[model samples]
Target: MDTEKVTDRKVELEKEDGHALHKRLSQVDPEMAAKLHPHDKRKVARSLQVFEETGISHSEFLHRQHSEEGGGPLGGPLKFPNLCILWLHADQTGPGPSVPPVYGLEVSDVSKWEESVLEPALEIVQSFIQGHKPVAAPVKMPCNEMENKRSYHMCDLCDRIIIGDREWAAHIKSKSHLHQLKKRRRLDSDAVTAIENQSISPDCDKELKEKGSPEQNEKELKSSV
Candidate 1:
């Protein structure tokens, strides 16, 4: 319905430690890691994600990105031209035609992504999704004036402390946490979905699962996305 619909699926994950990105970038490409731009924070974080997930150089990934863009038969032109440019910019579109990214790996935009920024960001993102301990938390608003201030406990999800009596009551009786508990309780419920057990999700697994008993019954979970 909105831009968030498209974007929210991919979390803007960040790590807790401030320099996690730098460390990850160094692992991906030490030379480029040294020159990352301060402003292009998200790109840096993505570089870290790519490296952590695939253990490849960001440059190699970009090269692969270029190669995969055109949707060429081998290394030639794309199958569909009109959809390539307009992107079929519609609601019901599946994935549209494959096209190359616009970035040229030759110049200024090169060192824009750094690991220093990415690692921490990634830590934050992982912590958010997994609900674990964050290396760093967002800064709180400054207390002022009387300083006696308000009294309320922080929310378990976002950690923002309740400010008023009404908020305090609501926080203590949060239905959202109840929903989370309910979801947790349904982790193995038949109606509840399941994901691959890592080794159980490859093509071999997919094929065997599609054929055999107990495996096919697993139902493959399709796309937890």
Candidate 2:
């Protein structure tokens, strides 16, 4: 085949490969597959390409997709107020004379909406589509049941060795540990107060004195003389 023909053939094969990957992805995670730019063949191919590079089976890849380690699906059932519409100016007039106008779009507002608002909305939409209400708490895989060999660190307050660096860090910053620390401080403060209340009199003599019988004292004085 001519170089040009060979190049065209390669491109055709790549497109076929991407479409096949998309078909599988649609069955496993339709929503995730939908997020790709359908018009951009290269972008569509990239997702499956990365998975292939991992050298794992397709089933294992799908398992990881929904795992916490994978960051799970981008959707859930948590609803959030529409920020862009909510923050839209009710009146599009220039800032009032009494109220100085803040010029330009609030980049922070846009960022907050993107980072926080969108996820919950997606989750809520997902739940509705899935024909279920959002779960209050996701069922977690126990540390003991996990396949990875993780290092553990001791949490003094919890008195347990939490498996994995992330778990240990979370435990130390957890409300349970914080509450225990607060209780410990209160107990220590009360003990100090009790000691203060029961302290020895301030006027009590601190000077040292020798104890001796009368004869011993007299003999010492005569010897000194």
Candidate 3:
């Protein structure tokens, strides 16, 4: 991929109106559009450029990549099958400090580096090499509900993109969205009422006057005679 060209395209896309670009993307690549936020201009542009250059949708390309050997539905294949990650971070201080998992080493204390960081990381690596599971079980985190399962929805009334059924339902029932709906209905009703109450135009009135009632026409004819 040409990084510079992609960057230029991204800049051009950012210069255009985000909503218009989003609408354009939706028409061509609805799946990709659904996955991206409209305001995420860089990514949105990259996807568009992929289509423009290759005549293939970005979503299709991603699907193909994910279908490759050792790949999962969500992402491309791992480079190393036996890869074991060991994360390291400084110890955090707060009311609710999130401690890292077993393989995650805290490098807060230099004196305890061997005990706190090096030893644990070595053990994890050793287990991987020996084809044995680490002493500590891996933590299982739940997948993101929106990214994994739900489809994106755009609310015409509210002029916003909502992800997932629960969020969409909540948005429609929101006070602001309801207010906008009521305002639009009221405007439409008022327009109808105005049209109904409108008086005849001057041209119509003039025509009516010229073609008077039958009795008036008869009187005018007699007068002329």
lDDT of 2 by residue, 34-131 (tens): 54433345644554554445655444555565564423333222243321111222334332121211222223466587545466555645665676
Ranking by TM-score: 3, 1, 2
lDDT of 1 by residue, 173-199 (tens): 788766765665786563334454544
Best TM-score among the predictions, by candidate number: 3
- For candidate 1, which ten residues in a row score worst on lDDT? 82-91
Model 3, span 50-130: residue lDDT tens: 888888999998999888886665567876666766766534311111222335566788899999878888888888889
Superposition TM-score, candidate 3 onto the true structure: 0.55
The 0-to-1 C-alpha lDDT of every candidate, in the order given, reads 0.49, 0.50, 0.75
lDDT of 1: 0.49
Q: How many backbone clashes does candidate 2 have?
A: 4
Candidate 2 local lDDT, residue 55: 50
Better of 1 and 3 by TM-score: 3
Top-down lDDT ranking: 3, 2, 1
Residue pairs with clashing backbones, model 2: 76-123, 76-124, 77-123, 77-124
- Steric overlap count per candidate: 18, 4, 0
